[model samples]
Target: MQATLMIYNGTAAPDADVLRTGGVPLAPARTTWPMCGNTCGGPMQFFAHLPVDYGVLSVFVCQNDPGACDTHDPVSGANRVLLFPSAELVPVAVPEEGVTLLPAVSAITTAVVTLEPEEADEDGLPPDAYDLARGGWKWEPGELFGKQREVLGSLGGSPSCLGDDRLPECPSCSGVMEFAAHLEEGIDRRSAMNLGGDLGYVFVCRPCSQGAFLRD
Candidate 1:
């Protein structure tokens, strides 16, 4: 999972706690990591601490060859890792470690860059290296939805949460609908496994069968 949760300046912004009327939370504005220069062989540059596991905004420099100085290679510098907010200052060897740990979430004024959503699967990298947390939430994106496998969760077991954010409304009747129930199996996106217990909600309107999938 990639580190999608970002820590932007949360001082007075509504990001503090402004919930949408329907109960879905608005995406927060956050300051992502920036591309600070590289460390000199003699003197190293230190990044501040971070809040949680975070991905690199951009990949520059060659971790494989510290002296390569070319920011466009697939060497160690071609990749990055999540940084804990309380790590001590450590010198990073690009080929050996593409990332260095910091003490706190990067300050509010850091620049925002984009990184490849997924890291190349490594032999021993932890699962979180590619898993991005959305506000402390661990959810697989909708990518792995078609694989068939075993079942689990309320996915198809009991009832569906009307909280899904994409339910459709009926144009014919003006009525409220909710996810009343779900199937008994769940479906994961990548594995094609029947992650059983996929919950299906029932939505029925007072005026008509305008009920449909609810918003998450």
Candidate 2:
């Protein structure tokens, strides 16, 4: 939610310290996720289309970007929001001889995502793997419906593995997960179109043999 802004004056190797995976890896090579929106977390890469430039030439913070908020629900399979920077002045590379620099813009700030939760995740990808499969769906003898009802009842019809957040995790265990498979179109609320064919990653915890899914 909160982030540190960086108005780089020159070219720098995308903060190698940051991450570069997940999502559709846009083009122009300018959008490189350097870090989280708050602290040292995951890298959220996306050129925010904020109405104004906040003088944030670059940024390093939590993966949560304020200007580029695209609420995408992998489970609901909806759309992703597109947030941008709030900078007023646009900076460009003017190579004079062999050097270049960025013109000062505005000021940038960071804070917890006070913005109301968007309808969907920003990447347009499912928040988690199970998101592809609604909560409490069960398997049964020619009647997966009953089993599903039971599962839903067990989950208290929560329709979510992770609290109210919609972020999914391995209830059976805890740890990072590995992408198992993807169920794009055919799957009902299985995954977002952005990640349907390229759904979330599945993980089988080493400890409990439990599984978790990350839609990213």
Candidate 3:
């Protein structure tokens, strides 16, 4: 499988037009900051600003009460993925309370890589596209182990080890959402968007102008 890997490019300005994690989100006027309404009624942490083919994906997750908020469920109200128009967006107002933004803003760049499936198991199942791509990322030549921390995530790939039943449905159109991106925790622990040591998945319903977020 071929995937576009998101490589960490060090700290960046908060409002740049490249892929980045942790910064004030840019959204249309009147777009209110989302809250974690599932368990903790605090503001959701701004996660990333990802520019996809369709639009910019503005992500948020609950950090006020991570484990208790059910951030891993798409419809749990603990995490959110908003598809915003790339143009005419302004920085969103930051909430005064709770964990609203990551500690730092990290820039990202892309690299195209080809991933080959590992030998099939006894059941003859192929290796997951995401797993294969993530495990094979090599930042430098001859490096035995890829620097997982430097890998922010990938774009345009299927979910890693996610079951078919877990696919998110679009709240606006009630149709199955299309896979958008795979997000990793990030390069620095203190500034990273927490995902409970699992990979984060982003799904979108383009026609409905909606998106969903979950982790696995």
Best by lDDT: 3
Report the C-alpha displacement of residue 2, candidate 1, in angstroms.
Answer: 38
The residue pairs found clashing in candidate 3 are none
Better of 1 and 3 by lDDT: 3
Q: Considering lDDT, which of the candidate structures 1 and 2 is the better prediction for this target? A: 2
Model 3 spans > 4 angstroms off = 116-119, 139-144
| lDDT digits (tens) for residues 104-191 of candidate 1 | 2211322222234554357653333212221123224665432222211111111222333334344455333432322112122321
Query: Comparing candidate 2 with candidate 3, which one achieves the higher lDDT?
Result: 3
Cα lDDT tens digits for candidate 3, 108-150: 9998877664677788776676666667676467887787777
How much lDDT does candidate 2 score?
0.26
The per-residue C-alpha lDDT of model 3 at residue 35 equals 89
Q: Model 1: runs farther than 4 Å from truth?
A: 1-164, 186-197, 213-216
TM-score of each: 0.19, 0.18, 0.93
**Number of the top TM-score candidate:** 3
Each model's lDDT: 0.25, 0.26, 0.86
Residue 165 lDDT (model 2)? 53
lDDT of 1: 0.25
Looking at candidate 2, the ten consecutive residues that score lowest on lDDT are 149-158
